[model samples]
Target: MSIYFWGLVISIAVYLLVGNYAGRKVQGLDDYYVAGRKAPTLLIVGTLVASFLSTNAFLAETGFAYDGYAFLMLALVAVNTSGYVIGALFFGRFVRRSESLTIPEFFAKRFDSRAMQVLAGYTTVIGLTAYLLAVTQGGSILISDVVGIPYGVALVMVWLGYMVFTLYSGSRGVVLTDTIMFLLFTLVSIIALPYLLGEGGGWNATLTALASSEAKPGIIAWHGLTGEGALWSSGKDALIWALMLGASWSLVLAVSPWQTSRYLMARSEHVVVRSACIAGLVLAALYVVLLFGGAAVNLVNPNISPSERVMVWAGMNMMPAFIGTLLISGIMAAALSSCSTFLSLIGFSVSNDIIKSQQWTEHKSLRMSRYIMFAAALVSLILAYFQPPAVMWITYFAGTLFASSWGPVAFMSIWSRRISAPAAFVGMLAGFLINIGAKLLDNAGVLSLPVYLDPFILGFFSNVICILVISRFTQPTKAALAYFETIRQTPKEELDPAEVKKTLIWPVIVMISGLTIAGLLFVFYAMPYAAAVGREFSLFSGESLLSIGYGLSVFCVGLLAFWQVRRVYGRKTAQRATTR
Candidate 1:
């Protein structure tokens, strides 16, 4: 067996050990559900990024970049990362305030409608189940190919690795293990980047080659390859596609059950905000390394067919055995972490929201939740066995479902006083149904929609329209209005002056981070690119603006965190409340 196989086995063994240790703390259902609602910023951020990134990122997204759209993917990033801050501030903190065990339950309580909760739960189960299958199949196939194992055996082995911890420890294990995996892939990306650059004759040579390649005209351009047989035929079409899907994915990060649910485990609203800012920073940085790294692979060999295999080709052929092993193991870890989260949510929802477990005993609830988790795993395993893998496409569909269906409703539930439960239900249903319907129709050649008119876009506008139109005819129930008002209020614990003071370091760290990004961009990226183009660097240059804008976004998000902490926890507000 290859060292890569053993590496994955060892990683899984370590995760299982640590997961079992974390399980010791799960003495009750809430611990299993929300890690006792005491997870700090690091753990929450870890799970958020881990769950969001899977094989889909390394394989599919990187492949897309290698196909000559690194800049476009980065274009998508500008819109996507913003959601972390937006969600943490407006939607996520309020979710913590709802104090609901699950996102669906929050919806149920917010609208005072059991049906809406069940409906929301069903969406979470179905969407996440498809996603789980994609990752599971993707992971198992990766292991089978690399380790020289049978695909069937690999499938079962990979499933058990994650299911074991998730079944027993739930959120506790997922968060802890996710943090470790996040570190692994992150380190691997950093290590692999310079190797790729050097192999292509460093930054200036590689960018110069990519920029001037006749065979790949416009490869690094803003619109990507706009020649014949390209995925996008024109710059206008490419930009439209970016703006459209960027907005859809932004919503996905904002209020998707998988993403926002992590906030439920946060120790406080402050944790929610801080973690989101840090996640935005980490995610953007990682994308630049991996996606740009993906494009850099072309400088070595541009003929790797099925472009998804580009990174894997680099791993096996370019890097050292150990780095290749780590890269493969890192991808496996991504799949496992995402599977753990999706399975936990699906099982937790089935047990808590759908079946309505007996809450009389903590032991009883834990046992019942585990049982449901096992059942969900079995169903997922069967599907994984039968289904063919389309790792990235499946990931894109399953993930974006929440953006259209739940995005508008989730924010509206919190921000819009005029929204009624009936409006919420219809809007949620319309978005899910319409989006799925459009996707199926388009896939089946029954509909002719452009890339910009993605099913999610159709669903999202329909959702908002339904809500706005229906809300005018119906009034929010008194219970719904009361719940909304309650969540809108800041939590009492957040007002502890000493508690707020301890976290004051976060704003400073964030501000310094912004300065660091700007400095690094000027020194590293902009200067190198200017030399490649045979021009002196200027702040007015495109590369400089990209770096400056990224730094400014980070700075502004941190500023929001600072101002929010002050407005909600300053001496005046603290004195108006009880204890400091």
Candidate 2:
């Protein structure tokens, strides 16, 4: 077998071993669903980052960069960072305090309604299954491409891997394996980027070539009037892009059931805060490398069809075959990590929420979870094998479902006292239906919506309006109000004032400064240079100053991340010593 095949084998072997080891720790339902709520800060951050950096980022987002949407990198960074901060601040502590195993359960407890729980559970399962099908299909394609195997065989192998790891180990195994994969993916991507950039003749020549080529002129333009005049017509498109692509997607990640489970698994409220910050920083740094690498591929081989393959092609062509194989394995790691999390969440929804088996023993519940996991994996595999149109059409469909259905409800549950269980249920159903209706209309060409007018915006607002209107007419139950007050009064361990100042306050300052500087660099230097580049820009010239500038900005952000992690962990160590 080739080195590429060996890399795949080793990756699969490591995941199986980790799953077996973690499976031994599964003593009850708690362990299966939430890792017994003992996961440390680093582990939580690892899994969260791993789950988010899936094939979507590896392929789809990278393809955008290759197609000349580099500005999206900045937009995504801003939106995702804001999302992490918002989630950590508003949702993380409250949800973790609720001690709920799933997002639907949190709703049920918060609203004191079994009906809402069932509705949320089914909605999550449907939305998450759509996402899983897409991810699994993407993974199968990647494996088939790399291993030279038939798509059908690769599909089965991918399915088996999902079943083995997630079925045996549950959340504990999933998170642990996620952490390992996150590290491998990050390290490989980071190592592969500079070589890829070099092969593209550095950044300057690449941009110049792209600018002068027959490809869309807007590919090189960052902001303002594009050379094509249609790609980003005005600031309206930019705002819409930021809102729908950046904010809505981030909102889904922030409030999604699969993601909230990570917050619930955290060891403490402090860990939740620290993990969010770490994840945000790690994601920011990685995106810098991946996005730039994708754009750089335009110079190495401009004719790479189906732009999504640019990253994969760059890895195989730009690096040694062995290293290339390892880099390609990172894509597989991304796919499996994300798919496993979704599968686990789907299983939790069915066995824990849908079944409503209050009388069942913990042992019985754990066994049922495993059985559901196997069934969910089988369903996903079959869906992928058939290559349904939903795979392509459901990108925003799934995000809109989660964000519209749960976003408003989750916000109201934590922050609003007037939201009744009935209102919450009605609001969620309304949002879900509105989103589906809009999607059907858009897909059928009955109504053509602007690029900015996504289903998420429609569904979210519809849900909010329904919630506000319905709650005004319907009184909240006294029991629900009382429970909300009790949770509100629960004494949370306050952060040490000095530690907070150093870790939290300073990191925020550093991040804002880094982003501001990066933005200025793009607006003033990089954007103008790309627009002005003519035939004079040489391919063999010295390193691109623009590329170096972007790299430096990324480095500054990364530096702040390292500083943040060290400060938080140092404080954690000091606190442990004091307790001892």
Candidate 3:
């Protein structure tokens, strides 16, 4: 076997060992479902990032950048990641407060609707299975190409690698191993970036060359390529598309079953909030590097077929043996992390929410969940075999299901007093069916959608319309209203005086870091680009504003977070004083 193959094998072996070890502690459903609800900020952050920064991001989305649209993807990401903060603040903390094992159950609890729970679980299975297929396919392709394995065999290997740990250890195993994988991939992303940049003649020369190259004109332009056959009609269209999908994806970050479900494992609401903040920061940094590497690899070799192999090609051809090995393994780690996460969630929904397994004996429930996970993994493997890899689009399609279906309902569930269970159910169903149906039509060429008013718009509007119309006609159930009130209160565990004090530090650190990054960007990124473009490298240049604008956005997020947290804390203190 190649060293890369051995590296992947060893990585899987270690993760298997770690997962089995975690399984030993799974005495009950709590341990299996949500890590006994005791995961700290670090573990939460690790899983959030690991579960998210999968092969879909590394291979599929990065390939989109390599195909031109690097900065456009970055713009979309900046819009999407804002959901982390909004989600953490509004939706995720309440989820932790509810103490549900799965997001489906959270909906069931919030509205007291078992059918809604099952429907949510049904969508979860369908959407996440598609996502799993994409990740598996991406991993299989990487292994098949670089590790010299047949695609069929590689698919099975990828399936078994994640399924073994997930079936055994559940969330306990997933979180711990996910953290480890997260660290590995994060390190490789940092280490591999400079090498990729150096090969492309550093950022300055690479930017100038990409901008000027006649063969791939506008490859590094603000909106990426434009005119005929471009991804969009024009630069403005690209911006609108980025913004539009960016908003949809933002909702995905907010209330996607996979993203919000991780909160159910957090130690406290504070951990949920802190982890979300940190994950947003980490993603901002990681995507810029990862996407840049994707665009930069064109300089190394622009003719890479399928574009998904750009990173792997650059790793093998441009870097040292060990670094290349590590890079491949890192990408593999990302694939496995998402696979395990999605697989475990599928099983949790099947056994817990779909089958109502809590009524069974503890041993039977655990055994059944494992069996269900194995079944889900097998299903995904079969799907992977037939589906030629279209990793990025597959992911985007799956992701839209949640944002359109769950996003509006999620926030309203926490804050709205009148959204009835029936209304929510219709809204969720309408969004799911409309978005998916439109996507199918669009894919089949029965109809085409503009960049701005594509499938997501149809589903999102349908959801909102159904919700508003139905909610107006039907009053909320008393039970639902009471549950809403129940979750709105801060949990006793999170209200500790010292903990509140610690939270104050988060906003301050975030704001300062944003300012520092903005300042550093002009010095490092803007000035260099300006020099390379034959323009005066000045503080007031348009390039400088680009960095500064992003930095200010981060600073604003921190400021808003700081203000809200203080207001909440102040109210809590006053309530206590009045009670005394």
Per-candidate clashes come to 0, 0, 0
Estimate the overall C-alpha local distance difference test score of candidate 2: 0.75
Candidate 3 on 23-60: residue-level lDDT in tens? 99998989999999999989998999998889988888
List the candidates ranked by TM-score, beginning with the highest: 3, 1, 2
Q: What is residue 441's positional error in candidate 2, in angstroms?
A: 1.8
Report the poorest 10 consecutive residues by lDDT, candidate 2: 538-547
Task: Spell out the clash pairs found in candidate 1.
Answer: none
lDDT of 1 at 512: 78
**Model 1 CA lDDT for position 291:** 81
C-alpha displacement of 216 in model 2, angstroms?
A: 3.5
Higher-lDDT candidate among 1 and 2?
1
Return the TM-score for each candidate structure.
0.93, 0.88, 0.96
Model 2 clash count equals 0
After TM-score superposition, the amount by which residue 280's alpha carbon in candidate 3 deviates from its true location, in angstroms, is 0.2
Per-model RMSD to reference:
2.6, 5.4, 1.9
Worst 10-residue lDDT window for candidate 1 reads 571-580
TM-score, prediction 3: 0.96
